[model samples]
Target chain A: MKGLVIVIGRDLRLALRQSADAWLAVLFFVLTATLFPFGVGPEAATLRQIAPGVIWVVALLAVLLSLERLFLADFEDGSLEQLLLSPLPLEVAVLGKVAAHWLTTGLPLIAAAPLLALLFHMEPAGLLTLLLAMLLGTPVLSLIGAVGAALTLGARRGGVLIPLLVLPLYIPPLIFGVGATESALSGLSARPDLLLLGALLLVMLLVAPLAAAAALRQALE
Target chain B: MHRFANPARFTRIADRVLPFVAVATAAALGVGFYMALFVAPPDYQQGESVRIMYVHVPSAWMAMFIYVAIAVASAVALIWRHPLADLAAKASSPIGAGFAFLTLVTGSLWGRPMWGTWWEWDGRLTSMLILFFLYLGHMALMHAFDDQQRGYRAAAILALVGVINIPIIKFSVDWWATLHQPASVFRLDGPTIHPSMLWPLLITAVGFKLYYVTVVLLRIKSELIAARLRALDLARLKAS
Candidate 1:
């Protein structure tokens, strides 16, 4: 448990020290969201209707963009080998890294999502649900992306490969997240979508770390 | 299982089995297609366009079946360190992708005539689309690494992760409101399909499975021979 905290703390500290990576993702999120109105026309009703899907998709992409460096730095500098050699279970270490990723990239996306939603002329009723859905959904993105990142660590053209490998897996969260926000916008109950997002988070919490750790071991070996 | 892990023995068995599988595939498909197109009564509602079901449904079945097969092979490769299992998984992916592609194409053809559109974002069709992408990912990852063995291991992990989609694909129609119809063949009670239709469907499905076996065996053999060629080349380089 301590080791998990230490790993998370270390990753968090590193992320804070060189903050541009997180900023780049947030900037991408905002800029891409800004493009929707220009491309789709500035009609308020149109933007409002499309807002949930647009935010969720861009947020998913931003999370994907930040995932490349999740383990690449450690793998390159040989610290990943040390982590593997340590007494900490590799799965826990993986989980900690994923958690740190969520804190840095996913949190910023969640914080920025509503501002984009507001710009999209989204209704106030769906605002809270959008935030709640992003909170529950983005971690699932980080977790699944970690597996893709770890799997492609030493592979050729990993950047191009990560999206192909990760995007299909991203479908469930996007569906539920957008579903929650849209339901709330339409005055329907968002509880079912929210609960499904939560369930997805729990399932990924168990599966991703094991799969990522396995990929890491093989990559290192 | 371990005994068959020997590539030479596996090759010998595969060689013996290949001729039979190929012949059976041809015969079954010939008979099945004839029965499907000529003998079986047309659906009262769908009429002639429903004939596509014989190909579409069986390809869908093979698509899912081959993925499950790959997942099992991946597990064996990861857990038991079985080299043959790795080769098997690698060999099977493109064939699985082909089946998935066939399912989509045949489905689209059937859909255009019946559903009045080439596509819909219904649960079954959407999940099957996802399954196709999953196959593409697996095939892409299998060739991503410069180190072929590392690629195999990475792809094995991916295959395991992707097994989650199988159940979702299987039950998506039931879970979501969709334009696609519900399951007809496999049920707790019995198949809802008429025996005339069911017989041709099963035969074509069996033929598809056999065709997969024939191609995968040939692929694995070529891979083994290719590895041998690489080994010989390296040995020659060292001797020089």
Candidate 2:
């Protein structure tokens, strides 16, 4: 448990030092969300209607963009190999790294989502639902993306490969997240959708670390 | 199963099985296509367009079935380090992708006439599309690594992660209000499909499964051969 905290602290410190990475993800999220209105037309009604999907989809893509860097630096510097040699189980270390990833990238996306939501003319109730959904959903993204990042370590064209690997896995969360926000906008209870997102987060929390550890072992070998 | 893990033994067994599987696949497909096209009566509402079900449903079934097979094989490989299991998982991906692609194309063809659009955000269709992308991702990851062993292990982990989608695809229609019809076959109460339509669907599904078996065996055999050739080349280089 202590080791896990140390791993998380170390990663968080590193991420803090290089804050641009987190900012880049936020910038990408805002930019991608901004493009939707131009692409679909400037009508506020149209933007409001599509806002849940547009924001969630672009947030997913932004999360994907940051995933490639999740393990690459550690792997390159041989710290990953050293960390694997430590007494802590690889899965715990993976959890720590994923936690840091969520903090750095996913947290920022959540913070930026409402402003983007406003730009899309999302209602206040819908914005809260979006915030709630993003809170539940983005950690799942970071968790799953860690698996993809770990798997692609040392692979050729890993940056291009990570999205192909992670995006399909992102579908369920995207569906539920957007569903929650849309339901909120339409005056229905968002409970079911939020619960489903929560369920996905729990499943990914249990599964992703183990899978990522296994992949990391394979990559190191 | 362990006995056949030896490549030489596996090859011999596969060689014997291949001819039989190939012949059976061709015969079943021939009969299945004939039955699907002529013997099965058209839907009263859908008319001639219902013929697409013969291919689309079977392909969709194979798409899910093959992913399950890959996941199971991957589990075997990861747990037991079965030499042939990874090869089986890797070899089966393209064929699975092909089945998934066929499902999408045929579904689209059917949708155009039935739904009046080339596409719909129908839950089943969207889930199936996601399955197709998962297959593509698995295939790409399998070959992405320079080390075959690493690639196999990485892709194996991916296959297990993706197994979650199979159940989702299977139940998407029931879970969501969508244009795609809910499960008519494989229900707890029993299949709702009429016997006339069911027979051809069953026959084609069997044909597709047999086809998958035949191709998988062929692919595994070639993969084994390629591995051997690489080993020999490396050994020759060392001697020189």
Candidate 3:
């Protein structure tokens, strides 16, 4: 636990030093949301209706964009080797990395989501659901994306391959993520989708890190 | 399984079996097409358009069938580290993807005539589309790594993870109301299709299954030879 915390702190401190990375994610989130209005026309009614789905999609993508970089820098710098060799259980260290990743990318996106929501004229409930889904969904994304990143560590064109490899698995989350927000906007109960999202998160939280750790060991060897 | 896992053993056995498999495949395909195209009675509702099912349904069955093969092979590779299991996983992917592609094309054809559109967001079609994408992803991941062994291992893991999609695709039509026709071949009490059309559809499905087996075996043999050549090349380099 102590070692995991130290790694998390080290990762967070380094991430904060590069302000552009975080801001670029925000820029993408906003720009992607804005493009939809133009593509589908700027009519307020359409934006208002599609707002929840649109915001959820962009938020998911924004989270995905930064996820590859989770272990990438460390993997390159050889810190990942240290982490693997450390006394701390690889899974705990993995959880720490996922936590730090979500802190830098997912949390900020959750914070920025409501602003995007208002631009699209979303209901407060939908905004709430969007934030909620992001909170649960992004950690799983980080975890699952870690496995993808680890598996593709030495693969050529990993950048292109990661999303293709990961996105179909990403669908279950997207289904429930968008579904939850859509329900919230309509003032219907969204618990089923939310629960399913949580269930997926729980499962990935358990399984993905183990998978990631194994892949990481193989890549390093 | 381990005895056959040896590539030399596999090649010897497969080389002898290939000709017989090829002959049977050609014969079955001819008989199946004959039954489907010439002998089958027209559907009262779908008329001639129903003929699409003889092609589409079998490909759909093969699509799902091949993934299960992949999943089983991956399990064997991961648990037992069987070289042939790894080869089977690699060999099965393209055949499955082709079957999926056929399913989509024939489905779209059937949908256009029956539903007055090229496509619909029906449960069965959408889930199958996702399955197709999964196959593409698996194949891409398999070749992504510079190291052949690592790529194979990662791809095996991917195949196992992707087994989840198979059930989802199968049940999607049942779980949700879909514009695509409901299950006609395998059902609770009996098949929904009449006897005349049923015979052709069943025969075609067998033919497609035989075709899948033939292709997968050929692909695996080729991959084994390629791997052997690579090993020999590395050894030659070392000796020099």
Candidate 4:
């Protein structure tokens, strides 16, 4: 238990000390979101029409960009090897890492999202739904992305490969996230989509750690 | 089963079954197509356009069927650590993707006549398209690693998780209001399709299944041989 906490603490501290990375992830999110209005056009109505999807898509990309960093840094620096060798169960360690990853990458994106939602002229309801959806959804991304990250450990061109391996799996969350916000904006009940997103998060919370641990074992082997 | 879990043993078994399965698949395909094209009566409503249903529905059936097969094989590989099971799962992906592509193409072809548009965000069609993309992603992930075995294992877990999406795809139209046609052949009640059209659809579906079994077995055999050649090379390297 202490070991898992230490792992989480270590990840959090490392993220804190290396403030540049957090800033960069935030920058990536903002820059990407800013680009969406331009790509889709400056018309407020049009932006509002596509806001939910645009925010979700950019959020997905931001999460993807940071995910490889989750395990790659540890694995390359030999810390991951040491972590595996510890008496602590790898699954516990994985959960801690995932939590830390979500804190660093996922939470910031949610905080930054409301501002971007404003750019899209998204309704206040759309913004609230987006935040709720992101809160539930992005941790699932970190959890599942951990699997891809662990799998690609030590593989050639893994940086390129992780997104290819992980993005298809990302589809479900993108669906629920956009759906929740769109439903909210359209005055339909967002409850079903919110419930579905929660269900997805619950599933990832259970499944991803074990799967990621197994992949880590294989990668380290 | 454990004793025969060896790649060599798997190859031997696959070799013995390959010829028979191939022959059976060929016979089924021949008879199934004949029945579909020649024996099956024109639909009272759809007419010649109904022919697409023969190919489309069967391929759609295979797409979902093969994904479940892949998931099962993946579970076996992950749990029992069966060597050949991973190959079976990996080897089956491209074939499944092919079936998915066929489903999409034939669906689009059929759509043009019926819906009067090439594509729409209809529930059933959109979900099927997503399923197809998932297959493509699976195959891409398999080759993503230089260590092919590791990639296989990773992809196996992915294939297992992705199975959850299958039911969502299957029931999408029912769950949501979409422009796509509702289930006609498989429903709570008897098939809505006419008996004249029903027989060929079922026959073609079976034919496609047998065809899948045949091709997947062949792919597994090739994978086993490839593993053999890898082992021999490793042995030679050690000896040198």
lDDT of 3 by residue, A156-218 (tens): 898888888787677667667777787787778989778877987887887787777777777
Selected candidate, larger DockQ, 1 vs 3: 1
lDDT of 4 at B215: 86
Each candidate's clash count: 0, 0, 0, 0
Write candidate 4's Cα lDDT for A1-221 as tens digits. 78778888999999999988987888998898898766878998898998888888888888899987888888888988998998999999999999989999999999999889888888887778889999999998898789888877777777888787677678778877787888888889999889988987887888889888988988888
Off by over 4 Å in 2: B168-190
Model 4 Cα displacement at A50 (Å)? 1.1
Clashing pairs in 3: none
Tell me how far the alpha carbon of residue A13 in candidate 3 is from the true structure, in angstroms, after superposition. 2.3
lDDT of 2 by residue, A1-221 (tens): 99989999999999999899899999999988888888999999999888888999999999999999899999999999999999999999999999999999999999998898889888998888889999999999999999999999999999999999898888778778888888899999999889988988898899899899999998998
In candidate 3, how many Å is residue B103 off? 0.7
Give per-residue CA lDDT, model 2, range B1-240, as digits (tens): 899899999999899899999999999999999999999998887888888999998998899889999999999999999989999999899999999999899988988988787886666677788888899999999999888888899999999988965564345333544322453321212566799998888899999999999999999999999999999999999999
Better of 2 and 3 by TM-score: 2
C-alpha lDDT (0 to 100) for residue B4 of candidate 3: 94
Q: Score every model by TM-score.
A: 0.95, 0.94, 0.92, 0.91
lDDT by candidate, in order shown: 0.90, 0.88, 0.81, 0.82
Q: In order, what is each prediction's RMSD in angstroms?
A: 2.7, 2.7, 3.1, 3.0
Q: lDDT ranking from best to worst?
A: 1, 2, 4, 3
Interface RMSD score of candidate 1:
2.0
